[model samples]
Target: MTDPGRPFPRHLRQALRTIAARVYLAVCAALLVWALVVTTTDSSDDSMAGVIPLLATAPVSLVLLVLPDHAAALVVAVVLGALVNAAVIGWCARALRR
Candidate 1:
């Protein structure tokens, strides 16, 4: 039986699925870029580990500019990215739930 209480329409559901997939792909791509950067750079010490977080933040910052003025974009990006990552983690956890 269909759940009448469900709020999303078919198209909206599809769109969310697409967004989630894209976010997953983007995260994977970002990780790959980070790995490449680390590999190419001199591994003198643990200092190179810091670059991964910076690279991850850059794309999120760019995405934030789409919503508001440039000055507020950094704050918006950080908040939005945190929320998105949290959602992704929750989704994964639910999928793994027994």
Candidate 2:
């Protein structure tokens, strides 16, 4: 059982405990890291590697596109987007199992 005093609700806590949630978050992390490495090492401006990660995280971070282009912005978008996506996807998976 979940503790009532915990910040996360029971459903969310349960969702995060599942394997699906971890996989989703892992994918996001991998993409984000790949994007960063490609951007830093590749001279090509049209590299799809960097863009792909942003696209993957676009569901939640799309709004962040309006923010000025900066390292901080990208980091925030990727991190937060990954987290939100994982939580939602995990929650849905848990719900489906019920």
Candidate 3:
């Protein structure tokens, strides 16, 4: 919905948010790929092996990528997502802070 032709504050803000979201999702996907690799490579016969939980995470990453049909639902999802992203990012920043 944002027009790149004009440099407006709202547009820039939205663009930044979109970029941040894509970056976050990409990081998650990368982690999922690593998990997939580990899950396949781990030869443990136990159902409760360390990599078993990785199997569960892949589906969640897939589900979150789905877009809701309704505008209100989309808005709610984005807002909630942004909040969660901010919290996690803040936490990570704190942990990694110098």
* Best model per lDDT: 2
The TM-score measured for candidate 3 stands at 0.33
Summed backbone clashes in each candidate are: 0, 0, 0
Instruction: Kindly report which residue pairs in candidate 2 clash with one another.
Output: none
Ten-residue stretch with the least lDDT total in model 3: 47-56
What is the lDDT of every predicted structure here? Answer: 0.50, 0.78, 0.45
Cα lDDT of model 2 by residue, 21-70, tens digit: 89877888898888889888888787667567677777778777667888
lDDT of 3 by residue, 26-89 (tens): 5545644564466567687442332322233334422453666543443334344444564445
lDDT tens readout by residue for model 1, 29-90 = 56545645665584664544433433464556456657765424544554465445545554
The deviation in Å at residue 31 for candidate 2 is 0.8
TM-score of each: 0.37, 0.80, 0.33
Which residue ranges in model 3 land beyond 4 Å of their true spot? 1-17, 45-98
Predicted model with the maximum TM-score = 2
Clashes counted in candidate 3 amount to 0
Better of 1 and 2 by lDDT: 2
Error of 1 at 73 (Å): 1.4
